[model samples]
Target: MKFTVSAAYYLLALLVCGVQADKEPLKDQSRLINLQSSRHHDVRLHCAHYPDWRIADEGDVLHFHSPHYPRLYPHSSRCGWQFKGKNEGIYFTINCQVFEMEAASGGKCKDYLSIKDESQQSQMFCGSQSPSLTVGNKVTMKFQSSYRKQAIGFTCTATAYLS
Candidate 1:
């Protein structure tokens, strides 16, 4: 009877230790994630992971950064997009990159610009499909069509390079 009690105590101790170990790793990882991307006034989208994801690494997230404004277009210098409502559509520009992040190490991150236009879905041209203005590490997009007007949603895959 005494031996059985001793064995049970040992097992309980082992289980407790295993649970503690598991909790600490998660806490530490979250801490690291928070520390790394604290630059944008605590703005970040942690839904993305490397190598595996639900949607293709193309354009699904909206990262708002005002610094990418003042584009010298044909007529006047204007921001790429002007989203009306919060849930009406998603808008963002991949101008500010995470240089210290491991996922953005190479220029191969496939965050593409997806243009969901049922009217022109059959079209496979560059500008007609999605406006993926890939300039080195930045991708800018302008959805000329609207949901009620033209039904074209844009998306882009953000990438990075070593140099």
Candidate 2:
């Protein structure tokens, strides 16, 4: 009878430890997910300060803005953004929620934003246009002013997908 009790106690201790070990990995995974979700702020800061391209994770909707957004951007300013998916199999979309720039003159934009895809397809916009576009897996965008005009700039959102 004493041996039976000892065996049961040892099994119970093992079960408890196994349960605890399972819980710990789950907790760590949850923490990692939370950190990834919080990367939006870091991405925005990086996009604002850097013009280089960066690959984003799937399902991450990243926000970017022109320098001094919602205010007059500097004259002759040049800003570029290149957003790519983590792999070539992924696709992404870009949409401008708020957009304003120098208006076109003589059928040409003095200050404009250009969006280009990996296929060499490109589009340019100016004035108060807000555009929504999708590219295969990578896209490049640039905002340029012709040293003569500045406006409220633009605010854009990009979301990546694995499709």
- Regions of model 1 farther than 4 Å from truth: 1-127, 131-133, 137-141, 146-148
Runs of candidate 2 with Cα error greater than 4 angstroms are: 1-42, 45-50
Candidate 2, residue 78: Cα displacement in angstroms equals: 1.0
Per-model TM-score on C-alpha atoms: 0.21, 0.70
Report lDDT per candidate: 0.27, 0.74
What is candidate 1's CA lDDT for residue 1?
45
Query: Model 1 misses residue 4 by how many Å?
Result: 40
Q: For candidate 1, lDDT tens digit of each residue in 89-162?
A: 32323333311111211443212222222123421222222334322222223222211221112223333222
